[model samples]
Target: MVVYEGSEEQTNRIFRALADPTRRDIVRRTVSGEASVSELAAAYDMSFAAVQKHVAVLEAAGLVAKEQRGRERIVRGRPEVLRHVHAVLDELELLWRTRMQQLDDLFAQEAEADAATRPHDGTPPPPVP
Candidate 1:
């Protein structure tokens, strides 16, 4: 299954944007509801312009969107992009699970081979402890 359906550049941008703690918080806030630039700025200790830059980064990554509402730029989270992120994570999890299963199968095969090679004299193996 193709996890990252988006372009490589887009995936990089999304990850880069999400790397920032403030931007992640912004995304979290916007996902619940839309907020104006000023409103978002007020929630943080940073300057308004700094918050604006974070929003811009998120917008560029397609994680969040901004629309002009009168003089204010209202920001809202893009759930579709987040869904893509989740899909990628799910794919990774599946890959790890498969790898673990393969390792288990290999260990089981090794154990079986070892048992088969053991002498049939009925002498039990030593205690593991």
Candidate 2:
């Protein structure tokens, strides 16, 4: 599916950032509201630096943003990016749905043709020409 917004590199970064389970969780957590990097690190077993790296990756993807609030780095989810992702997925779903409908219509037409060629008396149909 085609995304109307952002360059290919930006889209690739977004998808790459989301490919990780930890990153996805981070997005989910931050999306609800803002959270400190330390607070996020606390939720995971990994080191604080690891969490920071994840946040950096997310920041690079434009999926999340971090701001310094005094001594804490508060991370907030970019709802707009999430909305864009949803829109892209919706477009893909629509494309697939349309294709499936076309296939169904084609199959129905074939079925109708097959039925028309069958003998009403239940005898075997004629061989292919």
- Steric overlap count per candidate: 0, 0
Pairs in steric clash, model 2: none
Runs in model 1 lying further than 4 Å from the true structure: 1-5, 119-129
What does candidate 2's lDDT look like per residue over 22-51, in tens digits? 999999999998999999999999999999
lDDT of 1 by residue, 16-124 (tens): 9999999999999999999999999999999999999999999999999999999999999999999998887788899999999999999999999989977789988
Best by lDDT: 2
Q: Judged by TM-score, which candidate is best? A: 2
Query: What TM-score, over all chains together, does every model reach?
Result: 0.84, 0.91
- Residue 15 CA displacement from its true place in model 2, Å: 1.3
- Give Cα distance to truth, residue 112, candidate 2, Å: 0.8
lDDT (CA) per prediction: 0.93, 0.95
lDDT of 1 at 88: 77
